[model samples]
Target: MEISLNSSSNETTLLADDCWEFIFKIIISDDSCYFKSLSLVSKQFLSITNRLLFSLTISTLTPQPLLPSLFQRFTYLTSLNLTRFHGDLNKLLCQISCFPLNITSLNLSAKFTKSTIPFVGLLSFSKKITTLTSLTYSNIYSIHYTDFIFIADCFPLLEELYLINNLCGSYDNFEVDFSDSFTLYKLRKVRLKRQSINDELLFHLFKNCKHLEEAVILGCDGITDDGIASAISQRPTLKSLSLSDTFGLFSNITTHFIDSLVSLPLTKLILINCCKYSYAGIICLLSKCRQSLQHLNLLNADFLSDQHVVEFSLLLRNLVFINLIGCKMLTESALFALVRNCASLSEIKIEIIWRKSVQNPDSLMGFGVYPQLKSLYFAKSVENPDSLLDFGVYPQLKYLYFANNRWLSDESIIKFASIFHNLQVLDLSNCVRISDEISKLEVLNLSETEVDDETLNVISRNCCGLLQLKLNFCNNITEKGVNRVIENCTQLRKISLQFCDKVHNNVVDSMLNSRPSLRKIIAPHGLDLCDKKKKLFLSQGCILK
Candidate 1:
C-alpha cells in the first residue's frame, strides 16, 4: 500500500481542528463510526485510527503482550466491554489485569466456559475495584452461595449486575453471610438468572437497597412461596420486577403472593414459566394490578391455558406490553380475547412452540381482537402462517418480527403485507420461505436467517424509505443482491452482514463507493478484503466490517 507523502491541489483543509474534535467526540461518546470518520482526512489517519484499534468492544487483536500499551494510551476509556473477547478467562483475566483505575463500567462475560472464572479470582477483582458501577459477570458455572457473599463483601459501590444464563446449583447447600451492609447498600439492580438464590440473601437485597427498582430473580429454585411473599411485601418501591423461569409457581404460591405483588406497585413484571398456577392466578393479578402494569411478560407459564387468558382479557385493560411466548395451551380464542379486550396492549411476543404436542393445531380460535396493537414478535415454530389472519386487519402495525419458523411461506407475507401498510419495521429474520409478497416491504431484516436476493430486491425497491436493512448470514444473495439495493435505496442507513459467506471484497468495495448515504456496515470478521483495500474502504466513512 502506498502512503501519499504529498498533498493534492484541490485539497483545502480536509481535516480542520473541528474535525479532530468531532472524531474524538465520537470515539469518547461511543457513537457508531458512520458519522465519526466522515470528520477525518487522509493525512495522519493511521495515527488517529489507533484510537479505535484498541477498544475492548470492537477490536479482535490478542491483548496478551500489548495490554500495557492499551492501558497507557487509552487511559480515558470510560467503559471496557469484555463480553465476547476471545479465548479463555485466563486470557480475559490477563487483558483487564492492567486496566486503568479510572474505568468505571466493566462487562465480563464467558465467551468460553464459565467454570474457568474461579470464584476467588472474580472476588479479588470485585473486591479491589472501588469505583466500578455497572458489572455483568454471569454464569461462571455454578457460583456457590458463598461466592456471592464474597462479592457482597467487595465492590461496595456496585450498582447494576446481570447474573443471567448461569447455574447456581442448590443455593441452600451453603450458608453465605455478608459481614457489612455497606457493600450491598448501593446496589440498584440485580439479575438472578434462573439460579436457586437463597431466600435470606434476596431479603438482604430488599432490606439493604432501599432505592432498588429492578430485581430479576428468574428461575431461582430457592425462592419458596414465603420468600417471594416476603421480598415483595418488603421492597415496596420496586418499579421493574421479573419472576420469570420460576415455573414452580403453584396455585398456593399465587394465592399467597397475589395481594403482596399488587401492593408493591410494580411497573414491569415478567412472570414467564409460572405454568403451575390456575387461570385464576393471572385473573387475580390483572384484577388487582390493572392500573399500574406497564409491561407484563407472562410467556409459557404452562398452567394458565385459554381459560386464564379469557380471564385476563376481561381484567387487564391498561397493559402496554405483554409477552405470551410459548403459551401452547393458549387457544386462538384466548389470544383473540386478550387482543380484543386489552385496549392499551402494544407489544406482544408469541414464540415458536411444538405444534404436535397440542391436541389440536388447526383450531381457528385466537384471531379476534387487536385494536391498539403495534409491535408484534411471532416465533419460529408457528406451523400455519394463515393463523396471523386473526390479527383482524392491522392498519396501525409498526414493527413486525417474524422470527424463523419452518412453516412460514411467501403466502403468509403476502397476506400480512396487505394488512400492515403502516409498518415501519419488518423483521422476517429467519423464515423458511419468502415469496414476492416481501418485495413490497420497505423495512426488512433477514439477518442470521435466510432469504434469496429476489426477496431482497423487491424489498429495496418497494421500501424506498427504508432506514435499517440487515441481510446477515444470508447465503443466496451475491453482489447482485447488494447492488440491487445500493443502486436503488437512497435512504438506507445501516446494513449488517455478520456471516454471509458469499459476500466478497469486490461487493464490499462497490457498496462503500456507490452508496453515498450509507452510514453503518456491520460485518462479522470474514470479509475477504485485502489489508490496503480494507483500510481505504473504512477511511471513506463506513462502519465496522
Candidate 2:
C-alpha cells in the first residue's frame, strides 16, 4: 500500500514499508494514535499518510490540524464523505475537497452543517473534477441554478448523480449553456431528492440525459404532470421513475402524461403519495409501463383495490419490490395471486397491523407461500396467532418490519421469531405488547416499543452478532439494554434515540466513554441536552452549526 504513494513521491526520507503498517493498524482498529505516530515520521510521510487516511472520513473527527498538512493529495480519492464534517467547511473548501477537486465521486448530504461553497468555489471544484461519474449533494443552500450549470459543464462523462434535498437558493432564474448539447448523455441514474425546479431546467436535463435508464424525482414540488410528460417525451431510454412524495405531480388532465410513456422503455414506477390518483389513473399508468416493469410501489394513496392489483401483477411477470402498504380495500388474493405469477419476487410490504379480520375471514386466510421472498414488511399488521405466514419459506429473509402494530402479544412475537432463523433485522416499533423474543433478533429495532430492562437483557444475551440497535422512544429502558449493546456489538456504529425519555445523563456519558465503536448516538432533542453533548456527538458524525 505504501509503495503506491512512492510513485508520486520524489523524496526518499520515509520508507514505504514503515508507513504502510500505520494505516493497516488504523483500518483494523480505527485508531487515531497509529495515524498520529505515522504523521510524525517526516514531512513526506505526513503528507502521504494524512491524504490517504482522510480520503473518505466523516470529517468531524478528522482534525483541522491535519488539513493544512494534507490538502493537496486529491488523486487517491474516488468517494469523499464530507457532509458531517467539522471545522471551517467553506474555508476548508478553499483549502481541501475543491481546490484540487478532480476526484471521481463526491457525496454531499443535504444535512450539511454550514452554508459554504459559494458559486466561485464550487465552479473551481467542478472545472478540475471532470472525471466525475457519480455526484451526490444534499442540504445545498441558496446557491444559484447557474452554479449548477457550471457544475453540469464538468460532468460530460458523468453517469450517476444524486441531487437530493437541495435548495437552488441564489437567483430565481437559471440560464443553461446549450453550447454543448450532450453534456450528460452518458448518464444512467439521477435522483433529484428535494428540488423545487421549473420546467425549463427539467426539460434541459431530460433532453441532455437522453440515455438515462433510471431516475427518481423525489419531492420536486415545482414539476407538474404536463412538464414531466413534455420533457420526457423526447427521451427513449428512460426507465425506473420514483415520484414518491411528489404530491404536486397528480393532475386530472392525464392524457399528455399517459401518452408519452406508452411507447417508452419505462419500468419500475413509484407513486407514493398521489392524493388525487384514482384506481383508473393507476391502471392507465400501469398499462403503459407494465411490460418492462419488474418493481412497483403505490404506497398509501388508497384508490387501488384487489382487482386493480391482480390485473397489474399479471402483466408484470418480473415484479420484485412490490409494496401496496395501506391499500385498505386490498384482499389477500391480490397479493398471494400476484406472488405466484411474479417468480422473481423478493420483497413485499402491506398494511396489516396487529388486528385480526372481523370483516373478511376469507381474505385473511387466503395469504399463502412466498417461497423466494427475502424481506417482508407487515407495516401496520398486528400479531394474530393464525394470521401469520410460515417464516421457514423465507430462508433468505433478512429484514422484517412490523412497526406501528399494537395488538401483538408476547407469544405472538416469540412464535414469529422462531420462524426466521437467518433473520438479520427485525423492527417491532409501537408493538405495545411487552416482549423479549424480538430483542433476540440479530439487529433489533424497537424504537417506539415498550420493552424495558428485562426485555433488553434478552437482546444483549441472544443476539450476539447485532451491529445496530434502535431504542428511540423506549424510555422504559434504563442501562441494561444499552450496556448489552456496548458490551456485545463491537461492530456497532450508529444509535438513534430521538425521544427516549428514560435515558439519564450518566447513561449517555457511559455510552460515550465505554464504546469506542459508537460512531453516532442521537439523543432527545432538548437545547440543554444538545449543548452538553454537542462536542462529543460531533465526533460521532452529527455536525452542529
Candidate 3:
C-alpha cells in the first residue's frame, strides 16, 4: 500500500504553547539576552518572556508610581534586588510589602551608597511576607548590636544572613547585650564583615541557632580562637568557615585554633592574612579532616614552603579545589605534589615564582596524567623559558588562566593548543610576548597583549565557536582585524574593544550591523554615538558600553 502525505497540513500545524515556553526557557538559560530578541518575534513570545523573568532589580531612579505595573507584569519574581535604591528605603519597603508577591531572597545591600537598615519598614514587610529566607544588608554606615536582634525578630525564617557594615571605628562605643531573646533557630549561614562582634555574640548565635552550618567572619578583631573553639565544639552541623584579616598586633590563627578545627567535620576552610600560624598546627588540622575537607584557600600565607606543601598535600586526598595565591615560598614542587596525591582535584589557583637558577627544571617533573583537572590559574615567573614545556599535557583541561607571565610566547601557545584539546576558556592577559595562534575557544582574553591584525585573523579562522573576546589595551590591532573576527565568529555574543586606538566609530557601527548575534560591545572610549543610534542598537538587542 502507498501512503500520500499532506504537506500543506504539516506546514500549517504549529507547536503547542507549552512546548514553545519550554524551548524559550532552555534558550534563556544559556543567554538571557535571547529573551529580548525572542520578545520581538511576536506577541506570544513577548508574553512568555515576561512570565519567565523571576528576578527584578529596581533602583531609586525608577519611578515609584510605575512599580505596581512593573510588579504586575513580572508576577513570577521570587528575588528582588534593591541595592541601588537609595531613597526613602522605609517607604519603598512598605510599598513592596503591599504588592502580592512571594519574594524569597531580598538584597538591600547599599554597596555604592550608605544607608541604615529600615527597621520600621522591615517589621511591617516581615508581617506580610513570611517566605523570605535570605537577607543581605551590607555596606551600612553604622549598625548597633541591637539591630541584629531586631533582624532576628523580623525574619524568624531567615536561613542566610549577610550583615556587613563600613568599618569606620564607630563600633567601639556601642554596647552589646548577649541575651536569649536573640534567637535565629532557622539560621544556617551567616557572614559578618567588619563588625565588632565579641565572644559573647558568637556564643549567643551558636547556642541559639542550633542548625548553623556555615560562618564567615572577616575583620572582626574581637573574636578570639578560644571563643570560636568553644562555640564550634557545641555545633556539629558546621561545615564551612572562613576567617580573614582579623586586625590586631597579636591576633592570628594559633595552634589552639587549629586543634579546635580538627574535631569539626569541615568541608571548606578559608584563612586569609592570618599572619602567625605554626606549620605543625596546620599539618595536624589537615591530617584530622583529610577525609572531609574538599575546599581549602590559604591566601597570603607567605610562610608556606615546599617542604610544608609536600607534607600536607598527602593529607588532601579528597580535595577538589585549593587556592594558594600568595604563598611566595612555594615552588613547582608544590604543584607536583598536589597533582600526584589529590586524584579528585579539579581546580587550582596558585602563584609560582622561581627565585633561584635551576640547572635542569625537567628533573622536577612528576608522573602520570590528571584527566580530572579542568581549571588552573597559574601565574608564574621563571628564569628558564622552557619551564612550561616540562609540564605534561592536561587532556581534559578546559579553563586556563595563565595571566601575567612575561616569558609566554608563540611556542607556549602552540603547546597549549596541542595539550588542552578540550580547552574552551583561555586568559593570557598582560603577556606581552604572545602574538600567536589559539585553539577553538569560547571565551578568550588577550588584554594588554601585543596581538596584531595577522594574529587576530589566524584566531578568527580557528575560533569559530567564540562567544566572548576581550582585547582591551591592545593598541596594535586596527578595524580590519576586529571586523574580520566579527564577520567570521558567528556565535560571538560579547566583545570588548576598550582602548583600541586604531578601531574607530565606523568599526563600531559596522560591528553592530554585521553580527545579529552580538549582545554586548565594549567600544573604545570616546566613540561619540548619538542617542538615536544608541536606541537603535538597543532595539536590535545589542548594548554598547
Candidate 4:
C-alpha cells in the first residue's frame, strides 16, 4: 500500500491505488488532450497517464515514421484510430501487426481509392490481431461485395462494425448475391452509411449477425421498406434502430414491420428526414412500443401532429430523450403534456413551426413543472415562447435554445433568467423582444436580435462565466459594449460580430489589448486595422477571421 503525506494536514494518508486509477480512467475518457498534458507535468503523472491514455489516435497528416515509436511508447494501447491516412495503409497495418495481441478496436480511414489499395493486403495484417472486436473502416473507396464478405471471414470475433462513406462500393450498380458462406455470430452492432444496400445484402447480413443488438443504416437509398423490415425482423436481439436520411423507405413503414418493431424489446428509435413515413404508421408504432421505448427521435418528421406527440408522450412513461425538431405540426400543447406526465423525460427538442397556430400565453396557466427536464432546444420553433417563462421551475435545466422567439417579451426574459440558476447555454438569436435581463451563462447567442450596447453590458455583468458570445448582425453594439464584455467575461473564448458594420477595427484592437481569455473573433469585414494589430492577435494565439 502506497502512502502520501498531505501537505496541508501534515498527516500521512493511505493512497487508494484503485480509486486513483478510476479517476485517471475517467479523465482519459473525457478528454485525451488534458490527459496527455497531465503526463508531462511529472514522472509520477507520466506513469498513470500512460496507462489511462491506452487508446491512441494517429493521423496521416503526422510524420510517416510516427507509429513505430508511438507503439513502442504506448505498449498497452488497446484501441487505435488511423484517421485520413494517405500513406501506404498496408504498411501501417503490417507495422501494427508486429504488436497485434494488444489491440481490440481498430478504426481505419484510408485515403487511397479501392483500385490502388488492396483490401486483401490491409486485412491480412488486421486478421493477425485476434483480439480485434470492433472495426470502423471509412472512406475506403471502391469496396465490392466480395471484399465485405472477406472482411467478415477475416475478423470472426468482430462484435461492432462501422462501414462509412464509399466503403460499400458502387452505389448504383453492385451484385447482391454475396453468399451466406460466413456468419459473424458474435457481431452485436453494425453501422452502415452511404452504402448501396438492397434486400439481398441485408438478408444475408442479418442471417450472419445473429446477435445483432443495434443497427444504424443512414443515407442508403437502395434500402427499400421491405428490405429494411426483412433485415431487422430477422434480428430478434436488436433493441435499438437508427434509420436516418434513408430515402422514402421509412415513409411507408407497414403494419407488419411496425409489429416486428414492437415485438423486439426496442428501447431506442431514431427516425430522421424520412418524410414519407405516414403519421398514422408512426403513431401506431409508438403506441405499440410505448412500454419499452426510452429514447425517441423524430427529427424532421414533418407529418407528426400535436395530437401524435401528446398521445406518444402519454403512452411512454420511460422516455428520457424526445426530439421533434422541425415537426411543423407540433405545438406547445404537446410539450406541455409531456412535461406534466413523463417523469423520466430529461431532454426534449421541439420546434413549434406553425406560428399561425401559436397558442395564447394564457394556455400556459397550469402547465406543470418537469423536474427531470435538463435540456430544451426550441430554436426558430415558437412564435410565442412566453409559456417557458411561466413554466414554474426546471431545477436541472442547463441548456435553453429559445432562438427566434420574437414574441417573448422583456418581462418573460427577466422571469426566465431569474429562475434558471443552472442555465449554461442560452441562444436568444433573432429574439428582438430581448432587452437586457440576462442569466449567468457559459454560451450566449444574440445574433440578429435587437441587443444593444446596454444589453451587452447586462450580459457582461451577469454572465461572468461566459465562454462564447455571438452578436452577429447586432448593429447597436459598438466598441464600448464589446470592451465591457471582454473586461467582465474573463473566461470568454469566442466572440462572433459578423455583419455588425458599426464595429470598427479600433474595437477589435481594444478587445485584443484587453488580453482576456478570447480565442476566436469572427469580426466584420472592412475594418481599418494596422498589420501590427494582426501580428499582436497572432502572438496572443487568437483567430481573427
Candidate 5:
C-alpha cells in the first residue's frame, strides 16, 4: 500500500508504512491532542506521527518543558507512565536520564508524603532498560528490600509484574532475607498489592518465577497458609489464581487450599471477599474444577449452604462467570440448581437473603431461555419475593441487577422487563416496588427508587435509550422531574441528583440549560450554585458536582 504523490505539497498524498501503522493502532490516544493534530499534517505526517507515539504519560502537572519535550519528540517510546510524579526528584532523575532506553513498559507512580521517597536511579537505571518487559510500580513514596532487589535485578526479560500500594522500607532490625529472592526467570504475570509481601518473600518469589502464569494476590498480608500452599505447588504454569483480600488466608486454609488445586488446570478462580471459607472445601473445589472451571467468584461466600449451593449447582458444568455474591444460605433450590445446570452460563450473581422460596419458584420449571445468560445480579429479597417470578425467557439477559427488591411489584417489574429482548443495564436500586417499564434500558439505576414525575415522564417517553441516570435519593423528584429528564433523555450523559432537596437554583439552571449534551451533574449539597453559577458550571462543558 504505497501511495506517494506530494510533489512538495499541492496534491498532498503520501500514506504508506502500513497505512501509518494502521493509523497508529486505531488512534490510541492519551490525548496528545490527537498527535498534536496529526503532527501538523505533513513532513510525511511528522514521520509517521512520530512512530505512532508508542505510549508516553508524564504528569506531575506537566509543563516543566513538558518532560524534555516529550523525550525530544517521541523516538519510538514503548510505554512509559510516570503519573502523579510529585515533582523534583532531582528533576525527575534529570528527565529520566533522557529516557528512550527502549522502554518496554515502565510505570513509576508517585504522589507524596510518607516523607517523599521517589528514589530514581531505579537500580541505577537498570543498565538503561535492557529491553525491560513490563513493570508497574505503584503508589510509591517508599520501597526497599534493596528497592525490591534492584527492581528484581533489573528485569531479566521480565514478563509482567505489578507491585501496588508501595510504602515499605523499615526492615526493622533487618529481616527480609528471603535467601536471594530476586528471581525473574521470564516471569509470567504477578500482581502483589499492599506490599511488604511475606511468606519468605512470597515463597522466594515463586521459587524464581517458574513460568508463573497469572497470580494476583491482593492485600498481601505476608500471605500464609504455607506461603500459599508453597506457591500453589510451584506454578505448573498456574492458570489465573486471584486470592483477593488475602488475610484469613483462604479462610484458614480451605481444606488445604482444596488439596493444593489437585494438579492446577484452573481456568480463572477468584475467591473474592476472602474470609470464612470451606463449605466442604468449596464443594471440593467445585469437584476438581469441573472440567476446567470457567471464571467462578465466590463473592462474600458466607459459607454457602442449601446443601452446598445445591451441590455446587450440579457440579459446575463448565460454568462461565458465577459470582454467588453474599450467598445468604442460597435457596430457591440453589437458584434452580444454577439455572438448570450451568449450560455455559454467561453470568449470574445471587443474593436474595431469605424471604421465602425454599423451592417453588414455580418448581424450577423446564429451563428454556437461559441460552448463555447475560448478567443477572438479583440481590436482597426481604420476604414474599416470588422467586424470580418463574424464570424462563432470559434471551441473553443484558445486565439486570434487581437491587434491594423490596417485593418487586409493579406487575413484577413489568413482567421482568418483558422477557429481556436485549435489555441494557437495568439496576432497580432500592426497588421501592419497581416502577415504570424498562424500555430498552441503557444504564438506569433508580437510586433510592419509587420514581416520580410519572417515572420521569416514563423515562422520557420510553427510555430514549437513556445513558446513565441515577436519581440519588429519589425524594419524590422535583424540578419538574428534572425537566422531564432533561427534555426527553436526548442522549443524556450523566445525572445523579443526590438528595433531591426539591432541587433549587432554578432547577440547577434549567438542567444546565436543558442539557447541552449534559456530561455530569451529581448535586445534593442543596444546589448552592453561586460564583456565577459555578463559572456557568465550568463554562458549559458541564460538571456541577
Candidate 6:
C-alpha cells in the first residue's frame, strides 16, 4: 500500500496510498477538473482517483449507454446531478434506478430546457432508491402546487428540498390544495425561489414539516409579514430564515414580525433587497437574537446607514460572518465599529462609499489587530487610497478581494501585502492603478490591470510557488514576459491570457513543452487550434481553452 517517490537528491520517501487519496480528495474538493491531471500521475493514482469519485455530474454530453460502466468504475458515487441533461429525463431516471448505487442527493435543475418535473419517473426512482434524503429542482419552467404533495409522498424522508421554479404566465392561478394524509415529517431545510409560494402554502409547510429548521423564501411576493410571523410562530425549531426581494414588508410590519420571533433562538438571518424595513425593526431583531445569532446578511438594504450598523454592532459580539453589500449609506465608520465590538468576527464584506467631503484624518487609524478575521471583500470604488494604509494588518487574513477598486494604488498594495504574511489569494481585478510587484502568493489575479513585463518578471522571481495566475486584460505583457513566468514558476498549474494581443499562439506550444505542471491555459483571441492540435496538448496533460 506504500509507494516510493524519488526526490531530486535520490532520496526515497515512502507514502501510503491512503495518504495520496486524502491529498487528491482535498484537491478535487476545491476543483474536480484536477482529477484528469492527478489520474495521469501513475497507476496507483488512477486507482485512488477512481475511489475518490463520490459525486458525478451527468450532462447532455454524457452518453446514455455509458452510465452503467461509469457507475461500475466508480462505485462510491452518492451525489448525482442531472441539471443539464437535455434528453428524456423519465427514461434516464428509470435507467439509473436499475443500478445498485446508494445516491443520497439528486439535483434535477433543468437549466437547458423548460421541462416540468418528471413526477412519474421520480416516483419510480424514489421507490428504487429509498436512501435519497436531499432533492433539488431549480430553474424548472413550471410546477403546480399539487406537486408538493406528490413530492412529499415520493421522498418522505427528504431532509433538504430546493424548488426554484421560473416565473410562468399561469403562476397566479396555481391551486392551493393540501392533503392531510401526506406530510414531510423529516424535512429540515427547504428553499423556494421565484415561485408563487403564498401564505397558505408557507403555513402548510411549517405546520406539516414539524421539525423544519431553515427556510429560504426568495422573490415570493404573495406572503406578507403577518403571514410569516404566524407561520414562524408555529415552528419553534426554526433557527435560520432568509427572505429576499420581498416587497410586502414595511417598517411596522417588519417590527411586528421580529417581535413575534423573540421566543425562538434564531442563529442566522438574511434580508436582501427588502429595503422597506426601518432601522428599529432590524435593531429589534438583532437584540432578540443577540445571544444566538452567528451569521447576518443584509444585502442591498438601502435603508441601512452607519448609525444603524453602529447601534447593532454591540449585539453582534458572537457574529462570525456579516455581509453589508449594496448598503450605499454606510461609511468606513460602520466597518470599524463592527471590528471594535464583534470580537469573534471572522469575515466582513462592505461596499466602499464615495463622499465629496474630505474624510477625517483619524477615521481609519488605530483599530487594533483582529486575528480572527480571515477574508475581506471591498466592492465598488475607493475614493481615498491613503485610508487603506491606516487599516491595520490581520496576520491570519488569507483571502483578500478588492476587485473594481479604481483608485487602489501601488503604495497601498505594497503596504497591505507586507502586513498579511499568510496571504494566499489576492484579487485586484479592475484596479488599473496596481503596477507594482507583490509578495509571494499562491493564487494571484491581476486581470484588467496595468501589469507590464517588468511586474511579471518580478512576480515570477518572488512568487515561484504560484499555482494559478490570471492576466486576462494585461495588454502590456508579451510572449517574453509569459515565457519567463512559465520557466521560473515551476509550480504554476493554470494561466489565463485572454486579451493580450501581443501574446500569440506560438507561446502555447512553449508553455506545454516547458512546464509539465501546466494543466489549463486560457489562450488569447484569434488562436484557434485544430482538433489534432488540441488532442496533442491534452496528451501532454494540458487543456487549451
Q: Highest lDDT: give the candidate number.
A: 6
- Clashes (N, CA, C under 3 Å) per candidate: 15, 14, 0, 2, 3, 0
Question: TM-score winner among the candidates?
Answer: 3
After superposition, the stretches of candidate 5 with alpha carbons farther than 4 Å from their true spots are 1-148, 152-202, 206-229, 232-282, 285-308, 311-332, 336-456, 460-467, 470-484, 487-512, 515-538, 541-545
1-545: candidate 2 lDDT, tens digit per residue = 12233445644454474655554555535433344434554676566555555356546777777764444543455566767864454455555534454566766653545363344544555665566787777776544445456566755677887775555543244454555443577788888766657666777778877688887877766677777788777676787777755556555537787787665776677777766768776778677676687778888868777777778787777777888887877755565666767778888887643334445444544455667877766654433434554424555666777677677678777766666656778777777775665634556678777788777777666776676677877878766667776777665656766676766645666675676556566655442665556776555533222
Which sections of candidate 6 miss by over 4 Å?
A: 1-31, 41-43, 166-170, 246-255, 352-364
lDDT of each: 0.65, 0.64, 0.82, 0.75, 0.70, 0.82
Measure candidate 1: CA RMSD: 6.4
Worst 10 residues of 4 by lDDT: 10-19
Q: Put down candidate 1 lDDT per residue, 1-545, tens digits, no spaces.
A: 01233366534246665575565555445543432443254545534544443344623465467767766766556577766655555445544644644556777665446453445545555544457777776554456556565666656677887765554433435575755443466778988776656777677667777778888887766667667778777688887887754556433665558777878777788876766656666677767787788888877766656677777767678778878777766545565666777888888776533445455534544545566888766666555557666456777777777766657677777778778877777776666465454634456787655566786678677777776788777887776777788888876768776677776645666676677667677763466556686577556655545
Give the better candidate number (2 or 6) by TM-score.
Answer: 6
TM-scores vs. true structure, each candidate = 0.74, 0.75, 0.92, 0.78, 0.33, 0.91
Model 4: lDDT equals 0.75
Candidate 1 lowest-lDDT run of ten: 1-10
lDDT of 5 by residue, 482-534 (tens): 78878988877688888877655467677767766666778765667567876
For model 1, what is the alpha-carbon lDDT of residue 219? 75
Model 4 bad stretches (over 4 Å):
1-29, 84-87, 99-101, 110-121, 124-128, 139-142, 166-169, 176-181, 249-253, 275-277, 353-363, 402-414, 427-437, 443-460, 466-545
Tell me how far the alpha carbon of residue 302 in candidate 2 is from the true structure, in angstroms, after superposition.
Answer: 1.8
Clashing pairs for model 3 are none
lDDT (C-alpha) at residue 117 in model 6: 78
